[model samples]
Target: MEQIFKWLLTVSGGVIAFLFGAWTPMLNILVALMVIDYLSGMAAASMNGELKSRVGLMGIARKVFIFAMVAVSHLVDLLLIENKIEVGYLAMSVVITAYCLNEVLSIVENAGKMGVYVPETLTKAIAVLRSKPQKEEEKPVAPSTLEVPAVVAPNPPIVTAEVKKEEKEEIK
Candidate 1:
């Protein structure tokens, strides 16, 4: 038992050392953003009365896919024979930026839903991060004017003089 415990401790220490040596501030920021986004989504769902444990679990599963996508991007860059370090950093930066923006926006939106009065500056920042510009409503579209063709009636048969005489004889 003692031997097993020592081995486990050694392995855990080795893993921790590796992580600390390879860790970047950007990676930490990305993780923070991911957590915040998840929590904000949960809060928004609760506020909307649509919270479901199974759905939230699925949301988390989808969120985890972002990291897998980033990993795939890094692999692609390596396959392209680019500088692996620069490519990885660039990919991580972009993914982290997008995730951080999404999380912050979600948090702000949830706060708004909860009736919290956010500052105008913050709102503007969120809008810029989301890349949604305010716009005025435009004129409505005119309805199409294509006319439907009318149905034609079948021609009536003409009454002949012979047929009228036959009818008179029958009546007599």
Candidate 2:
């Protein structure tokens, strides 16, 4: 059993090394963000009483796709290197950064849905990161002009304390 476990571990390590070379800090951050996003999504769903196994499975599949794309990007980088191209993992960086930003945005949204207070500046920063530049002839809408609704809980908190206080004041 120990020998089998060791063999499995070695194979898994080999596969990961081939997929992502050296496990750079950026890749580590991307992986961390992916996990945080998924957990936050599940928390939000549970809070809203909307947890579904199908949705969770889909989320897991999407996360796997994200990593797969990252692996593909790394492979592209390797290809460029083999072709004597001077570009330094540009494709991989772009792909990973984009996915990381997306995961961050999803995490923020999930936190908001779960009634956590997220700063406006942080959300705006994410929005700016998400926006693409328009062509010279095209006009871009300012971020300030966008109307974002406030994140409110589906069920408001009961007013028991406030109502009782008001009743006491009336008696006084």
Candidate 3:
């Protein structure tokens, strides 16, 4: 048990070091938003009966890809400008703008799952975000038919399957 605990701690420490080693406030904020968005999305997906590990992992991959894109954009900016301030601002602008939009969208999506209707401003924002890339049109579609399982609490942010069979089906 002690060995297991030590191993877990070492792994956790390594992960933290790797992820935050390049930490800027902007990167920190983005990471926080990413985590919140992932969790909230998982909750919403569960509520809609669309939760799958494969889908969740794909979401994570996409999120990471956004950061990679931002990095590439920064590289381009660096090559173009002699002013470090200009390059920093350009990179920060690209990354922060994308993360801010993503966080707001996640909040609205989670609220929608909780049965809270979004305000028009938020809806418009979401629409704008959706218009970003042509691939945005492939956004995940919520199922038209979903039921609150008897075992799941009415107030749960995520819906839970009542039976093992349903859980198995969901995993598949």
Candidate 4:
């Protein structure tokens, strides 16, 4: 039984290393940044009273996709090496660097949400990422849709101020 456990562990480690490629400094930084970005995001959401299980689950799924991308990049790198493509492992480096930049941006945004004054350049980058070009016909909204709009009564009462005394008496 102990030997079986040891075999399983060895296989698992081999599979992981194969999928992740060589653990370079760039990969190490990417992983650390990813973790920090995720935790900072959670903290930001919690502070804003926006934390929800579904969103958290979605975040986990996104992180899984990130690793999947890394694996795909690594596979491409392997192909390049095996075929003598002369690309020199650019795929993995590109993937890792892209994700690291993304994580850094997210961490900055999270810090901003948590009331930390980030640098102007970083805030501008966040704003650029956040902004969407609105359509020409789009309208601005009242910030909160939670406030109920006014509803009319089923039957409104008749106004009597303009009615003459004779009319009032007749109605009575």
Candidate 5:
């Protein structure tokens, strides 16, 4: 049984590596972004009382569609290589990059819809996706990492010896 499981896993991994290129950081980021987008969408929808089973399934289908696009692009890239075209994964890279930016934008929108304050950097990603300006040269920044804001009390309560003593007596 263990051997069978290992064989299945190996076959599955091989198929995936072929359908998509060997797993790389870029692909990993794309997948992570997709998951975040989907979860955020659901959260935002529930917050708005707009959650529905049908819609949720549709979202899953859309994510699968994105994966299908990636796979098709990879297949095209493979075909090009077979023909000695030597495009070097250009099609696959383009599909993945486009989807990555799209996922980033969707996540930001989902956050906004959920009444979350999107970090400035993430908002800029939308602009970078839409278009860019050549006004000034600046160092390129990586995509913004999501961080849930921590809740802090407006004013922390102070503990005093008198309060502690009174509370102890009340407990008795």
Candidate 6:
């Protein structure tokens, strides 16, 4: 049993090394944030009675995709170096930073939804990071000042109780 455990540990270590190069501090923090986000999302969903198997599966898939993208970014870094280009790990760093921020935002949102008190400053920071500046041409137009015509429908004929009673008597 000890032998099997050792083998499993060795394989897992090798896989992590190959994927992340050296298990840097930033990578570790990103992984932790991803896990926290997922768990918090599940807790929030459970609390809100909104848990669904399909949605959970999709969430897992999305987490996997995030790592896949990071790996791709690392590959891009390696490719640049291999081709004699002097680019460093900038691509990987940018990709990882973006994903980490995204995960942090998601975790905060989940925590907030679960009735946790998230700090206003952190929320504002996230909003600023995620927001994109809009051009003047892209800005939404204000409400129109023009007046609109109202459609008036004719009233329907009214039937009284006495008329109904007379009609019933005639039928009798």
Instruction: Give the higher-lDDT candidate: 3 or 4.
Output: 4
Q: What TM-score would every model get versus the actual structure? A: 0.53, 0.70, 0.54, 0.72, 0.67, 0.65
Q: Where does candidate 2 stray beyond 4 Å?
A: 121-172
The better candidate by TM-score, 1 or 2, is: 2
RMSD for each of the candidates: 15.5, 25.7, 24.8, 18.3, 24.5, 19.1
Top candidate (lDDT) = 2
Q: Which ten residues in a row have the lowest lDDT in candidate 3?
A: 15-24
Lowest-lDDT window of 10 residues in candidate 5? 139-148
Cα error of candidate 6 at position 45, Å: 0.9
| lDDT of residue 51 for candidate 2 | 97
Off by over 4 Å in 1: 1-21, 80-88, 121-172
**What's the residue-level lDDT of 85 in candidate 4?**
92
What does the lDDT come to for candidate 5? 0.91
Question: In model 4, which regions exceed 4 Å deviation?
Answer: 129-172
> Which tens-of-lDDT digit does each residue in 39-74 have in candidate 1?
877887888898999998997887777666655544
Assess candidate 2 and give its TM-score to the true structure. 0.70
Pairs of residues at least 3 apart in sequence or in different chains that clash in candidate 3: none
Top model number, TM-score? 4
What is the TM-score of candidate 5? Answer: 0.67
Model 5 lDDT tens row, 28-110: 99999999999999999999999999999999999999989999999999999999999899999999999998888888889
Scored against the true structure, residue 121 in model 4 reaches a CA lDDT of 87
Compose the digit string of candidate 3's lDDT tens values, residues 24-134.
Answer: 687777778888888888988888898999999999898888777666655566566655445444754676677767786877878778677888887787778777565
Better of 1 and 3 by TM-score: 3
Local error of candidate 5 at 5, Å? Answer: 1.3
Q: After superposition, how far is residue 67 of candidate 4 from its true place, in Å?
A: 0.6
lDDT of each: 0.72, 0.91, 0.73, 0.89, 0.91, 0.87
Q: Cα deviation in Å at residue 49, candidate 4? A: 0.6
